[model samples]
Target chain A: MHEAITEEKWDIVIEPRSSLLSINWKEIWHYKDLLMLLVKRDFVAFYKQTILGPLWFFIQPLLTTAMYFLIFNKVANLTTDEVPPLLFYMAGVTCWNYFSETLTKTSDTFITNASIFGKVYFPRLVIPLSIVLSNLIRLAIQFSLFLLFWFYHLFVTGKISPHWELIWLFPFLIVLMAALGLGLGIIFSSLTTKYRDLRFLLTFGIQLLMFATPVVYPLSLASEKYKWLIAINPFTGIIETFRYIFLGKGDFNWIYLGYSCGTTVLILFAGIIIFNRVEKTFMDTV
Target chain B: MSGNAIEIRNLSKMYRLGEVGTGTLSHDLKRWWYKTRGKEDPFLKLGQENKRDTAGGDYVWALKDVSFDVKQGEVLGIIGKNGAGKSTLLKLLSRVTAPTTGTLKAKGRIASLLEVGTGFHPELTGRENIFLNGAILGMTKEEIKRKFDEIVDFAGVERYIDTPVKRYSSGMYVRLAFGVAAHLESEILIVDEVLAVGDAEFQDKCLGKMHDISSKEGRTVLFVSHNLAAIDRLCSKALLINRGKVVMENTPKKVIEEYSLTNYIPGEIIFEDNRFLKFLSLKQEGNNLKIVCDYDAPTPLEIPCLGFVISDSMGNKIFGTNPNYQPPKTPIKESAKGRLQIEILYPKLLNGRYNLSIWFGDGKVDYVVMENVLSIEIINMINYVRETYATASGPVSPIVEWKYDYKD
Candidate 1:
């Protein structure tokens, strides 16, 4: 029974039928321990020597939120759409953190992990997957901080209270942001393996993408003429939908949500296909 | 069926050997079109087989028409010279790269150690990398945990287990990597020249571990290396690859014997000194051939027989047989030494340069005429025979056969 199970698990002969685009997910599944190890390595090793250690997880989004509140709320006079500036930006920062972190690291996957991937045989997808997962730990910490701030504000105001709808959208929004970032990052990582110039473009591209998303200013504040542009931004709908349910500030346009989710799903599948293809023979080209 | 571990049929791998991106989009499209049409890749045909003899080629058939089977628990050594496609075969077997053509079916999990420390993250500690490398080698976390202590002990890096691999010396890092790799319980282990990096002691340790794993554990091992001694020591069966093909596959003894004989550089036939001799023919003599040049020869000289010797660029005498060993008793009127003709029959030297040392010498005296005359190129006489049968047949061969008739 044991032999049969082992045989059944890796029974398939992986003839080089096609490129990396055609991934054998079953093989990856067989080596899932490696994926888990990579995730653990990224999660623990990132802050191993730091004094603050895992505290930096909360510190990162907290600092970013404070900066956004100062710039977008204090200086730019951007409307928070009735939610407190702290709570307002926390929602945006929480979702945006997952996306940005996933994107930045995912795009650099090939370059950063080139040494390991070149010699070892593991699912290249495991790398991007681990990146997304490692960031998820940080997201959890940041989400806890956001909730703590929300309750503090609510407790102080007495009138402001948590809406149950927003609480439920939290996990959904996190997944959406992760899927979007991971999908795009995988695609970018695959492309950058050959054309490394994409890596340079991504640093600036991510900052520009921030403006495109309604993370700083609410989607409702955008002019109706340019609302389509905000809707076109995949993060805009997820972010707006997230804020609407959580802080009860931003408007949730189902049409935009549909578009964002559609784009996210499409990019996810496309990324998988492209990443799968690139992983197979990338050793040769990379 | 006696549990075949791996069955490879008509396996071939062709590599594009230049700068990868040199082929532009159109060129790529053209190449893709050519490949899609199932045409023989143009790149494979460009290079000569012997890479060391000539300047590097634009491309090579890293592996071509190589086919073999391994039985369960069989330790197969894949041995060859550099650029002989041993690594390519391992890479293909490990699925690091795909074969350009043909198909292979392997029965069990193949953990390929094409390199040690293959998946170790520099930023991660040795402890963390253990799990990482273990997983990359296809071991479960439970499996790694089960053998974690053994792995660390084998690597001998217990004190530095938590230290980042980047901080560790290359030896320590490879030790840790190989420790994890060798300890992992996999059905098949594919190791390529990774042992070449470790020191001799560590190499012996690794070879011992590999031997134990294959013999005791009954796991299949495909080991590729240029070290014939290690291969002979560890492997039950061996395959000798040459120019991307399996030239020989048999018991380790047979494969290594053929390899050594094929690669052996024939030693030289040297002369002690010159003497009063007219003719010395190495070809006329059977196996043993020796001659000396003498200076006190009271005779004239000749071109072909004039004391001439051969040496390498570094002045090592490769071959020079003179007729001076047995000097002529007749004293010449004029104090002139004569030349002697020497011919080597079936000079079994491999292709390389050699210098000839020449001089005139008598029974007890010698004088230099030409110290070194470099002129010799023994191209490999390797026939394209599928199998080179082993026989006690010496360098030169003579046909002899006998018919035996019994009462039956």
Candidate 2:
């Protein structure tokens, strides 16, 4: 029997609320341990029974890059602008995989997590944040493999030159891809709670978006009329900036990069607003 | 108001009836239009009372204007029939879902155990699931670590702590889950029928733990359960909710008595064939139960036997009585229809629901037999013992005289 009767006052007031600025940062901060556990669960539970386990992380991008090289470079004869086919396609594949994987996983947050969310009262944003963080770990592993190939090309062929612009461009491109993926993922997830048909459209839409990006071909190959069409895609600036900084082969423009950053911020805020609104009442409909 | 731990004011929750897909878009548009023009949403006014059997309108209020105050250290039992908004009330208190209208002011950290193993991942080990489940119930990592050994000891699963929960038996799983939940340190604990899991021994242990938490620690507890015996032993006050409304709030004994009297119906059946007896009404007055009927006899009968059987809710016969055991003082006359009332005193039945059936026959041939003609409920009012072992061996609990002789 441990009884301490103090006259401390801590009142919790609950009411019907529709406030756009009700995101409790302090509450989220308090549940940081739960968020870390969720991130660990996501990473560990994914490859529990698989024989290769985390080796699949490296193998996936390796196989995808090889297929892209064979199809685009050999069959379609796409140009890489003096960059080696291995380094060119691997850079694009590694960066795009992080973005697409984060987006796909985060977009299915409400559907895949209805059981946990319906029962508990933790901050709903923790699930998506864990998805993004877990995917970051996978991206780091694959990026190391890409650097292994980069060193091989550097020592054997001497065909690639690393640029000083990479000092700022590399981290900036990674953040841009993460923010963009998270933003769009939450937006689509909020909408998918009401309309499940959108989930079907998202898979094919991501596939089509890769062709619009500069993943297989350099941005310089697009004609002047179609270059704006490709530039409007935020990934174009990120992928092109990645290739230019790492391999020093593609063109990069500050204005297009700034545009992509601005769009990322806008979508992130919009996604947060929509996500906050949906998290409160989504249990009713879902 | 100052000493209250929870104060609910005019709380209500409205849900649309069916198919939340295509029709919701139009309703959303209409609601938005109403908001733009400074008008209330018309659908809110169309809500009916929540009766699952009846289909009436597009909207129903699961809880309607429920207001109550719980004292700082009182144990409150919420008793209700099915679909009586008990779970809805718990959900609102736990913040699982927001109310459509009204407000609740609660003082202290409210930990709700609405279900066992809420966030347990099958792929994770039992140790990891304890942390995960604890965190989901609003406990921090440090708190779980502090009670880690105690939880393992309580669950009696020390040998399988590192094994995946998927590999554990169902009994082990529930034990682990309840062990984690039992250690939650909150000022207010809200539980909803979670004790229905686990074995009888474990359930008794959980009841004792809940009693200790409330009485010893001076914490407020709100428990919703269908086990009237547990409610009688643990709760000081009870609230009876019917059709999404609070009907009564009083001491547990009085409220349970009123609830049983109003909730269950004592059935009646009339025999039109006129071969034997016609049933009238079966009612209970205090510990005395009386069954009234009419016996119409054509010819003079030497010996007519009449009996009534009592069975528990599961259709198991607890006990029965007949006039053949002891003859009546007076016999009925020939060609007379007379009202007969059979009164039994101090039957000493346990606290549970039961159904009554009546039978009539002469010494030579059987005349009439009715199965489950009436249903009645028996509640323990005078006996306040915490532990009653009679519920395990059989259903009937008759008070027999005891005589002890010392041989010294």
Candidate 3:
């Protein structure tokens, strides 16, 4: 009994720093219930006071798709690879909205939740992770709307032919976009704690980043020399590969999809490292 | 559970002195450069003590080599002046921020109540927020469900449990938030002045809950508060910290007595390093009380009035004096800076303990005031005639002239 006391076995030993790459995944797993609850908080409260409520989830992409079709397709005459204009714009809108909304909201994690972070102790990663999940729910609603239009066009017009064999790559692409957003978002959130001007830059930078992605214009329409530049964007391969699988007339394929996956892993890994360093002391700096 | 619940060794937290933007990037770059070169932090050597009002270097050590240990089930009361690093210590223990140096080893979950209602959303109803805040403080959903009714009953906001917290009055909101935190099940609890809120009755209820958490449940607790009575009543042991260091650790009564004496050291009185009066002393000789004060002044009458009050143990003013009523050669203002002192002789006072507080003013406004600067106790006293008074009848006992005439 005396030997079994295990006097030195402490459940938690906190120090000034931990290794940059070392993550306490088990500790985070312990707080999964908190993660789910926070996800509910974020997703449910987003449109709480609105008239239409969660229906706005479907309404938002519909409105954005119509607006983009008017400005980009009807006025500018940009091609959507000959897919029905509304369906084409809706797909891009749904996919891009997930990435952009998740990135923008998750990047404000530190600043927006400083009060909570300063007061209580939980897995700091829970916040950005919850944001990702909440945005995924929004994306799911918008994706169904897009899928409704796609099914209508596939059966009625019979003009668009989807590559059914490549359909397995669907959920993987959503995950890639989510990972990329979470990674970059946490990094920016960690950084903006010190340099507040990054916030102002990020608000517009995400907007400009949409044009960089092939959201409105097809990757095929990009000029020869600068096409490589657009391809450099991780989202380019993702959005293009998404269109190629469903719309069946895209220029990108599996190689670009692989490249996007690699980029997601790299950015997400770096983002976690930065976030781990920042979360401990962001309360003071913020 | 029989061993130490928490052990902190040389914990310290350093903070930058000024605003975070602009020069911070360069400092970060420089620190990164040093880290790359495998050198110690460059600015680590430059910080001074955490004296808030004083101008110091660009860095300050908020908690400097603070080390303490708590046995399982021991309730330790932390008493300190503001900015004395009590909050920093609690923050480190709660893992709110990592320390700049040193290690903290603790067993089991530790929940810290730095502020009540820490993540409570205004839009969340009282019931929803109970679940949300319970989860935030490390309670699972099932645990919150079990305690939900108890928390509501404790807060006595049962009628408005479904109402959004934004609609509750300030007192009601504080009560509800505190009720949620009080129910959190953890091995160790760190509370920081959270009982200072709510009405007095609710504060007592919170204190009672805290007492039960430590004594009845056998959990370790670290309580920080300025209320000495609460500390004395609740804590099994008390610690006094000053200037980011542990000044004393002893029984609550002795530690509190020593803490009160920090403002008035024997034979000298200095608060904030004698910012107002350079020297102050009160003494009793025979039947007279001697009050001497010295302060800095550029010219005579810059400080026109100086006085002290003698209050009973209950803080009721028994007697006081100032130079306003009488004129003296070489006025108090002219006699400041060590030239003169005031000595007053009155009829012998009753035997009782009294407190002496001093103040300096310019006849219109007080420049500085400090309480508990001196405490005087009078014992047996012989008046003009040889009559011994063992105890006090009134603040002052005076000899009265009497004749043989009886109601004539």
Candidate 4:
């Protein structure tokens, strides 16, 4: 056993690396258990003291849907492509919450985990990735509530119908949302570590982004002159395509879906590059 | 397969001083501009040594081109005064922050206990925190499971294992944190003054555990601490750092001796606020100690006192003497230079370092009070008690008369 130990070579060599592409994928894979435990911690810690516990997960999107229904559909007279207003708003709220929650939580990964990061050495990417995964659990719960309302409207009113497009399009839309959220979250997190100005801008910026996306109002209600303005948002394609797939009333544009996918991949790549670079030396500044 | 477990080559870390945000943007922009033109960073040359006393530069090198090697299973102690780059070296070794310019090649995993219980969440139960802390220390779930019972038992918190750590007392919290860190299976362990916290018993327990890890388990350990006795007991090899540079690397005894001597500031003006009395020298001659000072009395006083205090290395006062009780024969008057010498019989103190504080004043008004003016190393010149071993049982060894009466 002693001879065997002596024969083994060095396992790790630390150095001042200059390359932005020196991400250690194998080490991340090696620490997959840590990533999962972090996800579990986030999920459990979020509602540890709440009286309602996981019920808040469902109640949050439900209350938001009600508020949106009252303000946008009833007051502003916004259209929902002939679908039931509750179903429309619930669908939008569920999908939009998943993206926004993931983005907001993951964006604070470095700041929130600074104590842990400073004391230990693990793949820092594990933190943002865990945030993305944990938010998915909340999204899943909220999505179930949306599905319950959708099925009720389907049978009782016969106003909305399911589309075959959802079989492939639904998963694609979810992936797109997850990627975009994780991407933008890490990019802003990396920048915020050096200059905290971006942290203050992110809260209001995400709120404005929600309005820019087709969440409360249907894409078909957008005027032709302002349609491109909405289309410019990467989230617009995903949310609009999600409504189109589930309700079969909103327009489905393959070109827009393709554009959203491309943007997701681009942002995700850039975010990882920046995140990798920042993780190495963030302890110095942070 | 080399014997060296860690080889550090020209390791350095530079930190920008003051507001890092406002000035960083412009510096970054300028760096980028320079990089585009294929020139070296313009600001790299301005970094000075990290000296807390003087501020002259915008950047300081916390660790300046330090290179060292640690053989396998060596217990290396890093000793330095505050702001001496000891913690910064450990930080760089732990990869908490990357080096500014250097390379470190190491064999096997490294675990750094910079502080105990680094990632403990107060909301989590003791059992849950064990898993969390274990995972943060790079243990997998299966490994944590294997060591779960052992960790709880070692921490001696089995009764409250399922309760949240917030409810645990601070001692229990440190115990649990230390238990998790002690069970880490990393080959190289970096500890930074963690034993300074917790109680004396627990600190001794940790020192014992570190000894076991380095000797029996053959794990390489780098420990940094201000406790010289602890370093002397635990480390075979020690490194002394000063002003972000390694001043000496030698055996622990020699390094600690050199450290204490170098830290001693002799023939230096410790204080000069009033300047009514100026201390000259404190010298030890055989069994007698002499304190020389220059006294300048602004006005004649009824009783002027000259006093001195002697304290051990840990700053515990052993004894003090003042002439006020006996009263001096003459009063002092103002003069450009008036030398005064006071000699007292040195106590039969044990072999150790002691600090002397000198003061000269009238009965009520104080003229000068200089703290820690001189540090003297006492050596046992004669074994009067016939005891070869020098154990400091008390502050002073006094001869007491012994009387024995015959009893049936």
Question: Which candidate achieves the best TM-score against the true structure?
Answer: 4
Better of 2 and 3 by TM-score: 2
Candidate 1 Cα errors over 4 Å, as ranges: A1-12, A18-26, A158-163, B20-22, B30-60, B121-126, B156-173, B264-408
A36-151: candidate 3 lDDT, tens digit per residue: 88987775577667788888888778889889999998899998878888878887898899999899999999999988898899989999999999898888888888778888
> Which candidate, 1 or 4, would have the higher lDDT against the true structure?
4
Supply the TM-score for candidate 1. Answer: 0.75
Regions more than 4 Å wrong, model 2:
A1-10, B264-349, B353-377, B381-386, B389-391, B398-408
TM-score ranking of the models: 4, 2, 3, 1
Q: Relative to the unseen true structure, what is the C-alpha lDDT of residue B353 in candidate 1, on a scale of 0 to 100?
A: 33
DockQ of each: 0.36, 0.54, 0.64, 0.72
- Where's the lowest-lDDT run of ten residues in candidate 3 chain B? B384-393
Task: Show pairs that collide, candidate 2.
Answer: none
Candidate lDDT scores, in order, read: 0.72, 0.84, 0.82, 0.82
lDDT of 4 by residue, B1-408 (tens): 338899988888898888767789999999889989999888778899888879688889998989998999999999887788988898888888888888888899999999999989899999999998898888888889998988888889999999999999999999999999999999999999897677666777888899999999999999998666678778989999988888899999899778765643252343354557654566555666666776666676444566888887678888888876654576454344467677767566655456788777766666677788777655453345532212325546676799999796
Top-lDDT structure, candidate number: 2
Ranking by DockQ: 4, 3, 2, 1
For model 3, how does the per-residue alpha-carbon lDDT over B1-408 read when each residue is reduced to its tens digit? 577899989988998988987699899999999999999999999989988878879999988988888999988999887788888888888898889999999999999899989888888789988888889998888898999999999999999999888899999989988888888888999999987677656777888899999889999999998666678778999988888888888988788677655642243554446545677776655667677777764444554577778886568887777767565676443444553477767655554456778778766677778777776544333452433222224566766687787786
Candidate 4 deviates by what RMSD? 4.6
Ten contiguous residues with the weakest lDDT in model 3 chain A: A40-49
Model 4 stretches astray by more than 4 angstroms:
A1-9, B264-274, B277-321, B325-359, B369-408
Q: What's the lDDT of the predicted structure labeled candidate 3?
A: 0.82
Q: Count the backbone clashes (under 3 Å) in each candidate.
A: 33, 0, 0, 0
lDDT of 2 at A11: 65
